[model samples]
Target: MKIKFLLMIGLFTGSIIYAQDSLDTRPDRARIIGFSPAKNTKNVNGMLIKYYDEIDHEIKPKKVNGVGLGCNGLGIFFPALLLVSIPSIDNWAINDIGGEPLPDKMNKINGMQLSIINMEPTITNGLEVNVSSNISAPSVTNGVAVSPLYNFHHTTNGMAISTFANVSKKCRGIQISLFNVCKDSRGIQIGFWNENEKRKFPLINWNFKNKKS
Candidate 1:
């Protein structure tokens, strides 16, 4: 009984020491795969199922380098949708990539983002699949975004595909949807109604020249 008690005490002491050390380290350890609230200070390199809204781990910088499945955040960029309504001003002036400093949250996902409706003001460099809608404007998506309703973002360097609409401040690849809009486009827009800084067309629109749009 005395040996067992000693062993338990030793384990408790070790745990406290490790926790203290982790607070000072660059996240001494991480949760490889788990479902928890987004309050972890450690960076996640595997799958993370965020049950609650993402929060900033002010103690240290955090990132999710793998798959991220999140809700509770529909994005604070609803006003960016005004890019379509307000056509008089240049879209880049109000909201552009690197315009605002990123929040100290889980503001980046380097892999697949599975969103039932996830729209965080973060940069996503991989595939973003939204079951409903992804309205992460004034942010950036560097890969492909496949959505059912719409994909509205600040900048898309690859492709944006949606059934209803695809809107962006700047597009360098392609936008294919029922209604497509780009403030500055360097590629093609194929849809029923396409509009860019250059012109608006019915079937297709392309802007491959040096003209600034």
Candidate 2:
């Protein structure tokens, strides 16, 4: 059973890589966000949170589900942390359409036909630099978007970790590439974007150090 499971895992990862590789044809200008086990304590959380929050705040609801990123959705994205961020009115917005109630538009535009696979975290650098990933093929064939999601975890050393993912269609932006990360003693990071950005936004970062598939 273990052997069969391992083989299946390998094949699934290979397939994601293969499909993503087709869209990553221009590697020269691509952004590379590398993940390494941190030895330094000071810069570790800063870097991790910097990237983590960026993924959480900017990426989560924007891509994973179609809602705007907000404090309420933080835990939804980062289940490992269970941290709830209270949102100000500014964190939310309301728009009016001709004879349409607010809740109706929100219902249709704020949620996605989505499934979240694994969103957990490990500790590091006195923070939870958790990791998470989602596994869902796009539902709409053309120009559909999903909500942004966050994953939180803590390392054995008690470092806080969080991961983020978001997908959407833009009028003038580049394509969004999706893939998985299968290798990392601690975790694997996968990003999505076109060729111009310095980093493809991480849709999921999974920490598999203590767990086995």
Candidate 3:
């Protein structure tokens, strides 16, 4: 059973990578430094910067291999609003979105992302730090995601730390926050209120296998 489960997991990840690899055609370019609405650039090996007004989600997503910074000029009001919501907004989002959000537009990051708020979907493999109300994945693959608000990911194979809430449609790692939910949990959840495929718990929750299957 364990072997079968592992094989299924491997196949699932393989499929996602294979599908995304199709985006790397001849037009993809690599740059030392890049800016948002990255045009034809497919990879950024140094600094990648973005401004609030320059985003066009229709543009092809770039792969940032180093550092990313954006949403620089929101003054204090935007942050204050997000901070005020706290656990309430995070909880509301969880119930409203059901599981995790669909990633209509996405960028791939392999290092660090620091932003006031995430403007688009992301597949992050390193550190992600933000002041936004929620950070949903394409999935936080193998790193840490830190936010002052909420985090909801399609898959969680990394650590998620948030002040308000953390959730994953499918999980294989840890979540630390005020509220934590995992649709199909295979790891640990540490929070005030926790929910998983197995049960609803408080303070901590965990599920290692799908017994029903």
Q: What TM-score does structure 3 among the candidates reach?
A: 0.71
Name the weakest run of 10 consecutive residues (lDDT summed) in model 3: 89-98
TM-score of every candidate relative to the true structure? 0.66, 0.18, 0.71
Best by lDDT: 3
Q: Is 2 or 3 the stronger prediction by lDDT?
A: 3
Per-candidate Cα lDDT values, in order, are 0.67, 0.25, 0.69
> Model 1: runs farther than 4 Å from truth?
1-28, 34-37, 54-61, 73-106
Q: Candidate 3's residue-wise lDDT over 29-139, tens digit each?
A: 566656675444567887677775234346467788898776656523555765676554235333444354555566778898878766566777888887762332344
Error of 1 at 133 (Å): 3.6
- Candidate 2 residue-wise lDDT, 39-78, digit = tens: 1111111111111222222222111222211222343554
Cα lDDT for residue 168, model 2? 19
What is the C-alpha local distance difference test score of candidate 3? 0.69
Cα RMSD (angstroms) for every candidate in the order listed: 8.5, 22.1, 14.3
**Per-residue lDDT for 36-99 in model 1, tens only?**
4433345677765655443343323346789878654443244345434634323323233334
